[model samples]
Target chain A: MLELDRVGVALGPKAIFNDLSLTIGPGESVCLVGPSGAGKTTLLRLAAGLLAPTSGEVTNGFRETSVVFQEPRLLPWRRVTDNIALGLKARGIGRRHRRARARELAAAVGLAESLDCFPHQLSGGMCQRVALARALAVGAELLLLDEPFSALDVGLRSDAQQLMQQLVQERALAMMLVTHDLIEALRLGHRVLVLAGSPAALVYELPVTTPFNERTPAWLHEAAARLLRQPLVQASFQPLVDREAA
Target chain B: MAAWVRRLLRGIGSLTGVLLLVTLWEWGSIRYGSFMLPGPRDTLTAMGRLAEQQALLAAMWATSWRAITGFALAALAGMALGLLAGLSRTLGRVLEPVATVLLGIPPIAWIVLAILWFGSGSLASIYTVAATTLPIAFAGAQMGARTLDARLAELATAYRLPLAQRLWDLYLPHVVSYVFPALITALAVAWKVTVMAELLATDTGIGAGLALARVNLDTAAAMAWVVLVVVLLLVAEHGVLRPLQRRMEPWRTGH
Candidate 1:
């Protein structure tokens, strides 16, 4: 489990997170959605232990943790197989063993044919799959992803989302995924949380009772439309919608 | 054209350029007599005499050893110090100016200082070469280390990379991109500085052979020594460094 209790984060004089408390238990997938610049990445960073909260306690009880960033962060010099094996190598797994595991993960993520290619040679979605495979290679009980599929086209995005849902279910892995896309959040997460307002804190929390495999496009759209119609969700995303309009 | 055919065309172009340079050289030699500049044939004959005496091989070996050894020392020390400086802001501030000062100091000045310290031998030439080339390697490594991607560092933390793995997998790969180019430049500087130092302070290298040739007023022999130095440099660059660079940076080549 990863728990953040009344965590407050201040970057210089600007407060990003204030009195934010959350918990992600084993086998639970939590999705956070918010407008751009609403401290979504900061919150993920805090959960990943890459940032320290200015106040309150942040505790991660998971034995291992892995993160997938907004952009794929594979080492450019390493081949796809080696890149996917990075986290395994970090855990001191032997070369042959880690590579074998990496191959399996790559195949699972639909990158079996591109193992020998470098990151640059792969497309954006393929590179993101490699990054996903790398995160899985460590065998982390908790996976924290920050907009992992935001860069892909709609088709690839849905494909990646489906892949993620399947993996999370099969492994019984705990996940905290952050994104601005409402449908994406609803489609994959067991519980969806909304973060908004100045010095961001969770404004709404909704349990998504629909099964991962059962959440179809129409249901997702109808669900998202209902959530968007809520006064709090409207108020939270107003600035973002206004900015896009402008 | 096919890749190999294009490569062959490029090779032929290089040969043509070399032939053009030789033609100009022959023209100059004919105008100024063999006593002055010396024709390529005269230099080749002089080289043959030196080879028969085994002086050419011994001189080439000595010069190559000093240059290679000095470059190795500089690469080790400079990269170590550069990595240290890059990792710490205070160390970077303290050492960056020192690197700049070292770079500012001329190779000739270093040669003179080295001769006074090492007293006219291979050590003096080697020291001079190391001093002249150290700053180049240092700057490359420091830039590389300083410009490390913060995202990669975060990824390292998230993945819980061990220190050894961090250095080998994370840091070294990033640093090598910057360091390799610097090392190539430093290697070229190493050879030049070694020759310059040998000309003044040594008695057994190609530069020293040039000094001997000058004393005997043997212009052909001097030209022959110069040619030998150029060939050695070319061999070192193309045969060793380029191949090593290609191996280390196969990703960059996209092959």
Candidate 2:
């Protein structure tokens, strides 16, 4: 379980979050949706323990945690297998054991043939897959991803989403994914949280009980449309556009 | 064209340039006379004569030894200090200007000081070479260490990389890329500076051989020594440094 209890984060003099609280239990998938610069990435960083909240408490009960960033962030010099094995290496695992585990994860993520290829040789989608495999390699109980599939094209996005969904189910991993795409939120999250305004706080939360395999594309789109029709969801996104126009 | 054939063509093209230089040298020799400017053949003959005396191999060996030892010292010390300075702001401020001052000082000035301090021996020559090349290596290594990608650092932090793994997998590879080019530059400087220091302060190596030729007024012998130095530098650069760089940066080369 991961918990951010009434967290407040301030960067220098400016506050990015005030009184924001969220939790992810074992095997739960939560999606955070907001406009750009609404502190979605900041919230993920806080959860990953990469950032400390200015006030309140963060307690992570998971043995291991991993993050996949907006960019793949694969080390350019390391081959795909080595990059995927990074988290395992951090745990002081033996070379042969870690490499075997990396190979298995690479095959699982559809990168079996690209194990020897460097990050520079892999496509954007392939690089994301490598990042995903790296996050899984540590046997992390909690995975925090910040817009991991945003850079992929539509076809690749859906493919990556399916991969993420399958992996999360297989491992019974707790996940918190941040993205701006409503349909993506509807498709992946067991619960969706919408963030709004300066010093952003959660504006709305909705729990989707549909099984992963049962959520068809048309159903996802219709569900997303229904969520977007809510006054709070519209208001949550309005401030950024109004500011842009101003 | 096939890759090997293309490489062969490139070799031939470079050979043509060398032939052109030789032709120009021969023309200059004829116009100015062999006493003033030895022809390529005369220099070659002088080289053969030195080889017969066994002096040529010994001189080449001494010069290579001094240059390589000095370069090794400079590389180890400079890389260690540069990495330290790069990692800490206070240390960087203290060391960066000192490096700049060292770089500003001329190699001849260093050689003279080294000879005074070490009393005209191998120590003098080695010290001069190391001092002249250390700043260059330090600057390269410092830049490399300073420019480590912050994103990767974040990734390492998130993964909770152990200190040893962080240094080996993250810091060293990035630093080597910058340091390798600096080391190559320092190496080229090492050869020239060693020869200069030897000519002034030592009685061995290629520089001393050039001095001997000067005293005897043997233009061909002097030219031969110059030729040997050039050959050694080319062998060090193209034959050694380039191959090492290629091996280390295979990803950068798309290989």
Candidate 3:
């Protein structure tokens, strides 16, 4: 389980988050959905332990954590397999065993043929798949994803979402994904939280009851539209535009 | 096969141009009928004579060592300083203008100062070479570091990559793009400046050998020394530097 207790983050003179709290138990998946610049990424970074909160504590039971950033952060100089092997290498795994694990993960992500290809040689979708494979290869109990599929085409995004669902189910791992795309949130998240305003705070939390196999695009879009139509959602987003204009 | 053919054609064209220039030199020498205008054949014969005396080998070694040592020092110092400057805005502001001034000063203008500092020996030659080479290396390293992708760095930090891995895998690779051209330029300048410094300050090396030939009014020997330096430059370019560059940056080949 991973827990954020009354977390507050200050960036320079501005508060990015204040009095935020959340918890993810084993095998649970959560998504933070918000308009652009609602500090979803900042929240994700804190949860991943890549950054520390200004106040409050983040407690984790997991020994390992992995993050899939908005950009596919695969090393440009490394081949797909090597990038996937990075986490294992960090943990002092033997080279041969690490390569074997990378191969397995690459195959799982449908990037078997691209094992030797460098990041620049792959398409945007392929790079994201590589990133996903890298995260999964780490064998982390908690995965933090920040708009992992934002660059992919709709079809590729859906495929990646399905892959994420399968990985979560198979490993029984907890994940927190941050995205502006409501449809993606509805499809992949077991629970979705809406974040808003300056010194951003969670406005709503919605539980997703739809099964992975049973969910349809039309139904997902309808749920997303309903979520967006909430008055709090509009009110939450308004402050961002006003802040920027000022 | 087509690529090979194209490369072969380019080589042939270069050879043809050199041959034409040699032919012209021979014609001009025949018309002039003087040692001052020695033809390609005469220069080649003079080179053979110098080789027989073994002075050419000693001179080549002396000049080569000076250039190599000086350039190596410049590379080390420049990269260290450049990384500092690249990572810190204040350091860059403090040093860049000084580097620019040093770079602007001609190599010849510094020869007298180098002799005064190092006292008329191989050290003088090495100092001059390093002085000329440092700015190129410094600028290249700075540019390389500045242009490295911030996203990649953020990724590295997020992954908690260890210092060694970050340097070897990310920083080194990113710096190579600028470093290669800078290194090539530095090497060429180092050799030229070292030889020139030796000519004025010392009694060894190819440059001093040329000075000795001039004092004796042996134009052929002087020309022979010049030929030796040119040959060394070509060998270093092809046998050492080109191969190193290719090995360091294989991805650049397709681009």
Which 10 consecutive positions of candidate 2 chain A have the poorest summed lDDT?
A234-243
| DockQ of candidate 3, scored on C-alphas against the true complex (2 decimals) | 0.42
lDDT of each structure? 0.93, 0.93, 0.86
On the 0 to 100 scale, the lDDT of residue A220 in model 2 is 96
Q: Evaluate every candidate with DockQ and list the scores.
A: 0.81, 0.75, 0.42
lDDT of 2 at B20: 99
TM-score of each: 0.94, 0.96, 0.90
Ranking of all predicted structures according to TM-score, beginning with the best and ending with the worst: 2, 1, 3
Itemize residue pairs with steric clashes in candidate 2. none
What C-alpha lDDT, on a 0 to 100 scale, does residue B252 get in candidate 3? 57
lDDT per residue as tens, model 1, B155-218: 8888888889888988998999999999999998898888888999988999999999989999
Kindly report which residue stretches of model 1 are placed more than 4 angstroms away from their true locations once superposed.
A242-246, B1-3
Worst 10 residues of 3 chain B by lDDT: B246-255
RMSD of each: 2.0, 1.7, 3.0
Off by over 4 Å in 3: A237-246, B1-3, B6-37, B145-149, B216-222
> Could you give the TM-score of chain B for each candidate, in order?
0.97, 0.97, 0.93
Q: How accurate is candidate 3 locally (lDDT)?
A: 0.86
Q: Considering TM-score, which of the candidate structures 1 and 3 is the better prediction for this target?
A: 1
Model 3, span A11-84: residue lDDT tens: 88999989899999888899898879889999998988878999999998887788999889887777888899
lDDT per residue for candidate 3 within B1-255, as digits (tens), equals 699999999999999998998788789888986478777777888888878988778888999999999999999999888878887889999989978998999999888898787788988888888888998999999888878888877777767788888888788988987888998888888888988998998888899988988898877777777777878888898889999988777655523
